[model samples]
Target: MQFHIPAGVGEGMQLTVSGKGNTLGRHGGINCDLLVVIQEEKHPELERDGNDPIYNLNISIPDAILSNTTEIPTAEGRAKIK
Candidate 1:
């Protein structure tokens, strides 16, 4: 089933949806609550520190010599970092 998730939600968080689980015993009986466990997908260039995401960028020697803005990946998309 599909559900809405808000921003800044961390891993291992639990959410409960009422009346969305299997029936208690028989048909038309009381329904159980569904538990949703949040799991985070691994990011190739990022690491997790609690709720914060850390990205370590390595630049080439030539590019380091000449200062320029570089595009990096973010949760909202790509961002430029100087």
Candidate 2:
């Protein structure tokens, strides 16, 4: 089965689907609701803060001294920060 995760869902959040879990009996007993816990996969370039993705910009000493735009990885794509 497939389920969609809504936008801005945070880590450790729980979602329930009605009557999707184990059933009580064979004779028309009610099925338990399915509970899903949300877990965010670690991204190499980003960390999560609440539902927002954060990227710490770290520039080399030469780049910082030269005042050049440094390209860094962001959640959406590569970004340049001076």
Candidate 3:
């Protein structure tokens, strides 16, 4: 899945992700879980909620899963979060 970083993202920044959807076996289903880790420290784990503001900078999806079928663009926004 390709992720497009919005304009104004910077290095060493932190943000929150709200909702994400995934394909269920082959059909569309509920959004997947979001895990954000910074510099090896696991912090800011986000989930799908209607009231949350999905942050932009400090979030990332795996390249393998994203590239497998999704066409989301991948680029360097800041530090790698695993």
After superposition of all CA atoms, the RMSD between model 1 and the true structure is 2.6
Give me the runs in candidate 3 sitting further than 4 Å from their true place.
Answer: 1-16, 40-82
Per-residue lDDT of 13-36 in model 3, one digit per residue for the tens? Answer: 454454544434557565664433
**Highest TM-score scorer:** 1
Which residue pairs does candidate 1 place in steric collision?
A: none
lDDT of 2 by residue, 1-82 (tens): 8877799887789999888999989998999999999887789878888767787776789988999987878777888778
What shift in Å separates residue 10 of candidate 2 from its native position after superposition?
2.2
Candidate 2 RMSD to the correct structure: 3.0
lDDT, each prediction: 0.84, 0.84, 0.40
| Candidate 1: tens digits of C-alpha lDDT, residues 1-82 | 8777877777889888888988998668898999889998888777878778888888998888787789988877899977
Global CA lDDT computed for model 3: 0.40
**TM-scores of all models?**
0.73, 0.67, 0.22
**Candidate 1 ranges beyond 4 A from true positions:** 59-67
Q: Higher-lDDT candidate among 2 and 3?
A: 2
Looking at candidate 1, what is the lDDT of residue 17?
84
